[model samples]
Target chain A: MTEKPMNAVSNEAVDSCGCGCGREDLPWSGRGTDLPITGCRFSLYPMTDDFVSIILGALDKTDTSHVWCQSDALSTVYRGKREYVVDAVAALFANAWREGVHMALEGQISRGCPGDVSGDSVLSCEGEAPNASIVAAATQPALAKLSLYPLGVENYIDDIAKVWYRAEELGLNPTSIHYATRVEGSIRDIFAYFNDVCALMERTVSHYVLHFTINVNSPTDEEE
Target chain B: MTEKPMNAVSNEAVDSCGCGCGREDLPWSGRGTDLPITGCRFSLYPMTDDFVSIILGALDKTDTSHVWCQSDALSTVYRGKREYVVDAVAALFANAWREGVHMALEGQISRGCPGDVSGDSVLSCEGEAPNASIVAAATQPALAKLSLYPLGVENYIDDIAKVWYRAEELGLNPTSIHYATRVEGSIRDIFAYFNDVCALMERTVSHYVLHFTINVNSPTDEEE
Candidate 1:
């Protein structure tokens, strides 16, 4: 069967550099769909408990291919009010049998595998087991519904509220600025004002459609 | 007086690419300065009637500097959205004069000077006419406080609102998504949901500080 083309706009897991640099995927930094690894175009390190100390050092470099990993190795990416345990250390390679995009996810898998997940010994294995319910055994296609990391609505709404609250805690206000700002108006009142506007937009637009079209020209650096 | 070190961020117009890549003052595009223009970037086209056929089309590859500009040539660019003309285009060249950053600008000047502007025929003969408005004339040192383009609030706010409206239009609900999605709970909803979150972030963040920073290091794209 012929592989489908990736569209730049529609691609979620696919990576493409907008720089127009012509260099598709480089392993280091944000050049394309690369994790910030110091060496190598890409590396797939085996995650384990005391067996390794990789996650501690390059915590920021890990991507989302790791949902079955658990360790202090997980770096929390704060979306807004919600924080997800994003394991950068074990990114890309989701076990040898895995095919397709897998992020190094860091979360605790509950005892007793509920889904198709079967392993030598998940509890004792170095890598934290993900929700068997999410990944399903690698047999049929991996469940597309699972988050690279566990998340919910809180990641969106609650976290935004959290950041604002944090800003309030930081005491950075409209007048707190040092320069003559475009925000000459009241930013102290902006949070509430913006919240209202968002509410209105949400209410109005929620009735519309997102118009998702599949694009075949999108490129992912990791693919080639 | 001694000139400052070349390393310092200067106010003068410096076209790093050297071809009509727009001005240097507003040099950076994406990534809060994290992303600069990659290769030979393109400048936005000029928007006035005089610009449409007269100046822009007649521009030559060697015409980097406008020292020899005719009165009619300067009229269109110096015309409207006065501050944008100066702030985004003119000032970049001004600094470039001091620092020697050369580049080609895509657009052109024209005879379409606003009526309010002085259209002295004698001044035109001298190549020293008020083709553009001197309305936004100001000096350096007031750079941060300058109102050359005081539309920051409107731009950022509008951006956030626009994206939010787009997502809400998606009308995601419980039936569409797969996981614990607040609405449709489908896998695709995650991306839409995040974009919505980003829209909100862009909205709220615009109000905080013009010097805001964002470091988004996500773990994975999505393992499908």
Candidate 2:
């Protein structure tokens, strides 16, 4: 069957700003700054008698990416250009499925909308970085939440404590089955830290299930 | 904190095979054969400008599974002892998430009950396979359906024709956005074929989203 390009159709009709800002005046719009920005936060639950071993094996096989990726006991978070984040996750699952493993996943994806202050910056690619002109055209963000029950590995919550300790170390209080935290930085800095955290978790745990909630608030947004 | 074994608590109260079969008579009940058997089926939509290439790259990286896995243009279906299926999936997502990719998924999970004849035979391992006496303890089946909407990759139906051709080849009719097929065999054999179909699809497409509906019927059931 012939496949149609998802973005071939204009996104303008549906790109209204959540904050009621007009599209024309939104940041990241003029000149070459209108590129899309997307982010996703997700968690994985590995199911096995030796789930720790399996998680370690999977982490060992993971390759670093340009997007921001973070892992705690509850979940992993990734933030970057929409396509980059999606590509990173797709590669991850494809690798795991090939290995006869099972897992459950839950996550959220977000993109810049007319009034989205959080997704204002364009993702950088080596020599080509976002300039002042591009940064000024940022838009609002569009987001969606999702959950995957591949192989029906719903028992991911079994390793919650692994992340709970991490959360505590990060000065965030955690509940029995959940934890929360906030990171602050420019989009690039946030992703860099995210990548570091994921690497650390990969090195620390053998098997794990994590749930992560990511909010790409403006770097200037007040901390709660 | 100490981690508690998830199954240390009694599942007997809730373990009635959906079909109404007595758990005691089931094959996997005695001799520590009572491992959890969770299963899930899912589809993914790669949201990228080069989605086809991204999907192709992702599928290339997929490995075979002990769990039964099948894919057509619309969705992928996986079935097996719950843990194996879940573990296989966990590995897949772990790999995908690491790549910073995005996709959407939808699927179902089912297990035997008193009335589910198709789910009766216990999934076996090695020399201690289920015998006639165990098969006699079959039951009904219970199932649940779910969907994942990461980054709104819900337009997975874009490649309906790939499945349409396969459906035609199998002499089964298909709809605009869906397809149907019935497999008649011992649960083990049925899952075996399911795995084969998924492997074929993985090889054929780079990026694909499939929607699948699977019905495992007794060999005695009449074909449509």
Candidate 3:
């Protein structure tokens, strides 16, 4: 049999182990389940006089059926499949967007955590993402700074550079910041870029993250 | 003179070039001034119905004499000396802290950006950090996730691991998350750790960043 990299095993390939001894179920293997456990923790800031209402109303409108959500004082965390997690964030942001009030959201989204198995139970839940309909909805201009980390990977900088190059290819014109890449585009294109980066890295890196700081309806843009 | 790695030049060493040809003042060098050119962009969230007053009060209390401040729709950006940038964040958080209120702050702090030279005008402004007195004040329990990026470095992950290991030595008990390291400790200790990590990486990397998401007085902790 050809050798594969330690973290390159596809979800289907990891479903069963050789000899069918149920060794994959053992704790020592560190392979909790076949599902791609994904989750995100995010905080939203709505720049309005009625900030509390805007934030609360958006969270209330978000549909978290396929995901498990925990709302702490610091931030809200959604854990489940990748599509659902991303959908929940989009729904929350879209719901919170006001015409005159600018909004910003900071979030860290990750999949395949070696120590986090909490999402394994709900990984098999079936259905399209709840907010898939909103993908085509008209979105305001969005500016974001995204930094991805391929944990435990030796050539991590190369992976980052690849993502940067890919973003540029999509006409995003990524600007290199201190530790992040800044991109300005429509919300639809931005989210698509986020998904594309994840797809590129998941093939080789078991655990990866997309830490995003997004701003919509900025007053500075209007002034310029 | 021996060969030196790029970005390793000390602040004092970069003051003048050999033979004093006045080449350093030109725009081609991409070096605007002698200052280190530090800055931070941050958003604060207080989990309370009176969040507006609390946030406004904190900003009013913070002494920004040594830094330039810009409040945008999404977040506030502070530019100046490294110590003042850090101190502004600490001062803002401390001033905003209210009893029975859980507060969270998200910020990106960076020094030595090649493209940014706005802080050059105030580069020589000198004073001890304005928030130095608050450093020793009793602070609430703070939980934070910090990710440092050393841009353009080949062995970036190795540098990240070094910071992670050093955090362990300080008894911060860092938990490896997707793109960040989570640490729970006193606010003072946590900020100190942030400084230590920056110092460790700044020696070799020119444009390094500390993206911090900090939460204080969480209700979830009391539940436990």
Candidate 4:
């Protein structure tokens, strides 16, 4: 397998293990709210065009799901053919304070992960890492937890979209949107990725849960 | 009319003249984007049960939007006619921002030019002013160069709503959502208000022109 370098882009050796070889939630430190790392510093994964498109598609569809707390878009990953790696921003803060999540990062996406994509998820756009180096570390999960939210996890996509758009309108860049759909090539690739993830969720997770509200936020949408 | 009080309920009614009473455009202030002499400094309106109902009403019709931009609560106004508001912290913020009309103390409605309530064109709520005060302010071409959007001016409502929900989900108070909505509402309202004044536009604004765009970097909202 490639080692956080250009040669690692081949995907010839991805999914080796699950102990976060590349799924470093540690970078999520100081990102999510209310976490033990609330103020502690840590670099988060960079948001890419693929990151947002997948989230948007999953948000619209009825089957796929991921944790969604918007501190910032760190990175995105479609895993297990059904789940996606979603680390909501400042989740710890929101949960603890009963308020909105607030992480201090902008243009978080369109940035890229700290190292390389490391072949964690199936997004073909992985492999490109952000030029910035990591100085902080992810507070242990004991300090804060990031998990995919089940379907119907408090419908807030519309609200989130507004934040995304309004920020852009005000010249905030919000890179998440501009890069996702506006960037031409990435849009098509990401859309296809979400389609596959949603399909898998419908066929698998929905069946497993049976009547347990899989992708409950959006049932009719085929690509949410 | 109650004379401007030197010490007021949060500095909302300081300038007896610019009060959105007999005039428009924050009559108290002589400039655009300027809060009146005695304006709401609390950045919020006091919460009462009636105010709570408004919140429920707003949330009820949130789904009609195609994009999260500022549009009327057409769906919510009618659909949630009977819905009760959530008196929770966020709801308080939403109601204030929606009803406050950008200028907290200097509200257009309070000024007496009840622009256009013919349909579900705007968010009209109960104000503390007496009928006599507001009615007295109503006159020919009553109100200032305020803008109200087209009744169906909803190209951006969906987008605004998403940011709103995200703000809520992110744990920001409904004010963020309300402020966003009001900005949209004000943009639409100002457009409408101005249209009423000028009665014509040289060109069509847009199929997707946001009735309004708000400042996310508001001094307080940055509290994260």
**In DockQ terms, which candidate is top?**
3
- Candidate 3: residue A12 Cα off by (Å): 30
In every candidate, what fraction of the native interface contacts is reproduced? 0.00, 0.00, 0.05, 0.00
* Residue lDDT tens for model 4, B60-171: 4223221111111110111111111111111223323433221111111111111111222222333322222222222211111111221112122333334334324433
Indicate the residue-level lDDT of B81 in model 4: 12
RMSD of each: 22.5, 22.1, 12.6, 23.0
- Comparing 2 and 4 by lDDT, which wins? 2
**Candidate 3 TM-score, true structure as reference:** 0.64
Task: Encode model 1's per-residue lDDT on A1-224: one tens digit a residue.
Answer: 11111111121221211111111122212111111111101122221221122323333333333222221111122111001111121121223212221212211111111111132111222344232222222222111100001011111233223323433443332111011100111211222222232333233221100100010111111111
Model 1 scores a C-alpha lDDT of: 0.20
Candidate 2's docking class is incorrect
lDDT of 2: 0.30
Note the DockQ of each predicted structure: 0.03, 0.01, 0.09, 0.01
Interface RMSD, all candidates in order, equals 23.2, 23.9, 17.6, 24.9
lDDT of each candidate versus the true structure = 0.20, 0.30, 0.60, 0.19
**Residue-level lDDT tens digits of model 1 in B21-72:** 1112222122111111111111211112122222233332112232222211
Clashing pairs in 3: none
The model with the greatest TM-score is 3
Native-referenced Cα lDDT, model 4: 0.19
In candidate 2 chain A, where is summed lDDT lowest over 10 consecutive residues?
Answer: A142-151
Residue B197 accuracy (lDDT) in model 1:
40
Give lDDT: candidate 1, residue A176.
Answer: 12
Over A83-119, each residue of candidate 4 has an lDDT whose tens digit, in order, gives 2221222221112111111111111111111112233
What lDDT does candidate 1 reach at residue B7? 17
